[model samples]
Target chain A: MISSIFSQLFQTLLIVVLAPLLLGWVNQCRAWLQNKRGAGVLQPYRVLHKLFHKDAVLADNASSLFRTAPYIQFACMVLVASIVPMVATDLPFAAAADVIALVGLFALARLFAALAAMDIGTAFGSMGARREMLVASLAEPALLMILFTPALIAHSTSLTTIVEALAHREFVLYPSLAFAAVAFAMVALAENARIPVDNPATHLELTMIHEAMILEYSARHLALIEWASAIKLSNYSAIGIALFLPWGIASAGDWNAVPLALAVLFVKLLLGGAGLALLETLSAKLRIFRAPEFLGTAFLLAVLGMLMLEL
Target chain B: MATFTGQLINFLAALLLLIAFAMLSQRRILSLIHLFAWQGFILALSTTVVAYSTHQPHLYYSAFLTLVLKAFLLPWILHRLIIRLNIKWDVETMINVPTTMLVGIALVIFAFNLAAPISQLADTITRSTLGIAMASVLLSFLMMITRHKAVAQVVGFLAMENGLFFAATSATYGMPMVVELGIALDVLVGTFIFGIFFFQIRETFDSLDIKNLEKLKED
Candidate 1:
């Protein structure tokens, strides 16, 4: 029992620590693919540290609600990161919340952030708030529908149960899963404010959705939000891996299973980060109005995936 | 009968249904053609799979004919016809897309319910796929009704034939060899006639929109 606690703690620390590294790796890969000398992979960590040490600057009209939102969002992310079965299955904490609650966790974080954005009363912030809500309203349903396929396949909604079922099942290519994976990958990219949904690297003000919402944040508030976004990206990638590529994760209670699982996770993260960067570099961002159509396609694919499960 | 092959055939049948839905909702004429061709390709693949597993030789020839006639020849001919007609842009539908999709879903459920008893009567390895085959035919018919252009309707008509052909292979191991040959000739000749009809329609009305044909009926 004590070892389970220790492992859960380790998993929490691992998700928080690796989140920024994954973001930095994607950025570095994007730069390299664009034929430019890139910022090092440790750049996000340095930015986080610098922002933490700086003094926070608040608007004259800032509310207590605005001041409290960054922490709430950050806490939600940490809690979500802690519960998802990343390195080990059958973790004692996996039962605390299932996949649906995990989605609710994400939505809670977005709600806090959007509320904070509106609290500032700035034009850009409100516009960004509206856009973020629009994107989320479309994305959340697709996200739930995407989870339905694996949940149905595993016959459970708990993350660990689903992961264990996939790890133990005999291997065959599933059409429903293939369609869901594609849809989930698209949603993840959109939810993380990546390319073809919203460019993470663009500086043009009108082209921004995520960055606009954070225009008022400075110092550690910015640090926490930035870290939360990184955590969001890592959380999504881990969920995708747990569903579509379920091998090498340790479910046994043996103490010796830890090292191989960690090594496997590192390799998976590295490949996932590089592939995300490659895709972001290849695709152009769509017009804001067209985002609904993109998410609609994801929804269509998810619906088809569920229907395919029946056939 | 390996379970793996059974599952694989089921997966392909689902893909055929997916393409059928795509055809039903697709707005662009070019993409509708592509979806039709994809249906043909999946149909051919499923047939080949069934033939290999069931030790049927004639289904292989029908599969080849399907690949050439539906996948390659018809799409190529349709693409050429549209480019020559310059009517490749617009494909108006009778109803909005969401309504069409909802009705398509209802049709799929109905097909599943209808095919249940019939599938139990068949002894083929892919008998369970009968529902999907029927769903594809209904979806193609839906596409034909919703589409406004003559060319799009023609593609929909051809896609319905593809579904019917898929239904034959899955239910009874395909029709006789002579019947298969006759259908192939009929489809090829039909496409050519449709091509000539397209030119005459354009020449007579200066457009390919079938709504103009309503004027002839009224007069």
Candidate 2:
């Protein structure tokens, strides 16, 4: 029991610290792909460290919700990090690792951030919140359909069990999972505020969704929110790994296998980050009106996955 | 543990059905959204209790999702939408309240009948409540159909989803984490879209009455 607790604590710490590094890595990759010398891989960590030491600056109209958004966002991401099966499948709180709950964590963060954005009563903030919510609503159903495909095969909603089942190679060629995977990827892209949904790199108000909401925030508050966003990105990647690539996860009651599991996870994160950057680079931001159709396509694909499962 | 869980689920299912009835008979949009929130709270409480009783840790997350989305976030959004759209004073009904209530009762009966066969296949302790859940869903749908206001219709739609979520939890423990997360995202996004729709509706008709939308429907 003590060992499990220790491992969980270590894993949580690892994710919190490594999240910034991963973000920097993605940025560096994106820049390299664009044929420019990017910022150093440790740039995110440096920025975060600097931000934490600075005082927060808030707009005069900012309410309590705005003041509290950073903390809430940080807490939500931390909660999500704890639930994911990062280094080991048999996590201390593996039972709490329901996919739905993790989504709730994301929702919690999004809700606070969006609310904070609107609390300031800025046109851009409300607009961003509106757009964010629109994307979330459509993305969610498709995500649920995708999950049903996997749950049908694993016969349990527990992430640990699902990972173990997949690792054991219980079955092969889940056409439903394949479709769900594509839908999930689309939802993930939108949820994370990536390309074809909203550009992470752009600052234009008309095209901005995530950035516009954060425009009013400054200093430490901005840093925490940014750090949380990085963690969120990593968390989504980890979720993808847990669901689609469950091979390297160490089973519960296997403490001796953790190091190997950690090494495998690092490799997966690297590949996932690179792939995300590449996808972002290849895709142009979709028009605001086209987002629903993009998400609708995801929803259809997800439903297709569910229908395939019945076949 | 099983008995406690079974009783708790039964009580929650009953509460959900009652709320469904309330939503159906409600003439005020504000009250309907409040009742919908109360239903979400009950769903969250029951999910938590079931998670505790069965040692299904993931259900706790499900409960949290319910609390966040149904109880707090969605309601808050609706309230803001109501204020912004300036529809706080008017709530029009397509069907008379008493007639809507009677139709809701009939829908409930139909739901129970439809759910009976499916419930028989479920092995969970809350298996019997699946019928109640399905009934609530149908009644919520009936309420949606009977409401002439856009906001009320959205409330009914959300209520229907609440019933479906309850059924998912009670009949099958809970959905997979990914699906739950996905649905939660959908709900959050859906609310935003609906909020935008409410604005558009008001802009078009200068009122939230869905009767105006009928003009757009071809003969």
Candidate 3:
């Protein structure tokens, strides 16, 4: 039991520390693909350090909720890291929350962040909040529907349970899963503010989505928000790994397998990060009005996946 | 494990159903034709899988005919027609997308319910996918009713034919070779006639939106 707690703490610290490194890797890859000498992979770490040491400058109109939202969001992300079985399947919190609770956690963070964005009463803030809600409303249903497919297959809502069932099953091509996987990839990209949905690097103040929401923050608050976003990305990648490729994560009885599991987790994150960068590099940003149809297709694909499983 | 080929046939039928859903949701005229070709391609491949598994020599011919006529010849004709007619326009839907999709889901459930007894009576390894074929047919019919462009409706009609061919292949195996040939020729001739009618409609109405036909009916 003590070991399990230690493992949980270690996993949490490891992912939080490594999250920005993954971000830096993706940015470097995107730069290389775009034919520019990019910032080094350590760039995000340095930026985080510099921001944390500097003083925070709040908007004059900020409410108390605005001050606490970043901590709430970062805490939510860290909690998600602990709940998801990243490097080991022996987490004490593995069964603490089911997949629905996991989704609720995401919604909780989004609500506070959006509330805080609107708390400032700025046009960009409210506009960005509304846009974020729109994307979240659409993405949330598709995400739950995607989880339903695997949940049905495993007969459980626990993320750990689902991963174990999928990992132990003999590898056979599930056509339903193929459809769901593609739809899940789309939702992940959209939810994470990745390219073709929202450009993470773009600074066109008039049309930015994620950036506009947090435009009021500076220094330590900005650093915490940035770190939280990085953790959110890592959390999503870990969920994807658990659901689709849970092969190498060490099960509870196998303490000796932990190092191997960590190695496998590292390789998977590297590939997932590079692949995301390539996708962001290749696809052009779509028009804002087209987002509904884009997510509509994802919803449809997810529904199709569920139907295929039922059939 | 006892029925590998049977499982593969079911997989292919699922693919066919997915393509049908894609076509129903699609809005671009060019992309609709591409999806139609893909449906035809899947139909031919499923037929070959059925033929090879069941040792039916005539199905090979049906597969070849489908590959040549539907997948290659028909899409080529439609592509040339669109290029020549300068009708590179987005398809207009009569009903909204979400409603159409809901209706489509209802139709799929209804198709499975409708195919239940019929599938039990059939004696093929791929009989289980008959419901999917029926769903594909209903979905294509939905496409026809929803779209406003004449070319899109025509493509919808051809996709319906593809679904029917899939049903024939999945239910009792391929149809008689002569009937298959006759249907193939009829579809080709019908395309030519439709191509001519597009020009007439465009000349008379100045656009390919079939809603103009309602004006004529009222007059």
What lDDT tens digits, residue by residue, belong to model 3 across residues A1-311?
99988888888898899999999999999989989999999999999999999999888989999999999999999999899988887788867898999899999999988999999999899998998898899999999988888888899999888888888888666767777888889999889998767889877875578998999989988899999999999999999899888899988757899999999999999999999999998899888777777887788778877777644
Residues A164-228, candidate 1: write the lDDT tens digits.
89988788768889889989998998899999889887767788999889999999999999999
DockQ of each: 0.46, 0.02, 0.45
Model 3: per-residue Cα lDDT over B1-89, one tens digit each: 42777778877888888888888888798999999898889889989989999999999999999999999999999999999999767
- Show where candidate 2 strays beyond 4 Å: B1-219
Docking class of 1: acceptable
Candidate 1: where are CA atoms >4 Å away? B88-90, B94-103, B217-219
lDDT of 2 by residue, A1-311 (tens): 88778778887788888999999999999999899899989999899888888887888878898988999999999888877787787576767668777677788889999999999998999999998998888777767777777777889777777778877784455545766787888989999899889998899978999999999998889999999999988888887888888877888778888889888999998998999889888988899888886776676556545543432
Give the TM-score between model 1's chain B and the true chain B: 0.96
Each prediction's whole-model lDDT (CA): 0.89, 0.81, 0.88
Residue B184's lDDT in candidate 1? 90
lDDT score, residue A297, model 1? 74
What level of docking quality does candidate 3 show? acceptable
TM-score, chain B only, every model? 0.96, 0.94, 0.96
**lDDT of prediction 3:** 0.88
Candidate 1 clashing pairs?
A: none
Better of 1 and 2 by DockQ: 1
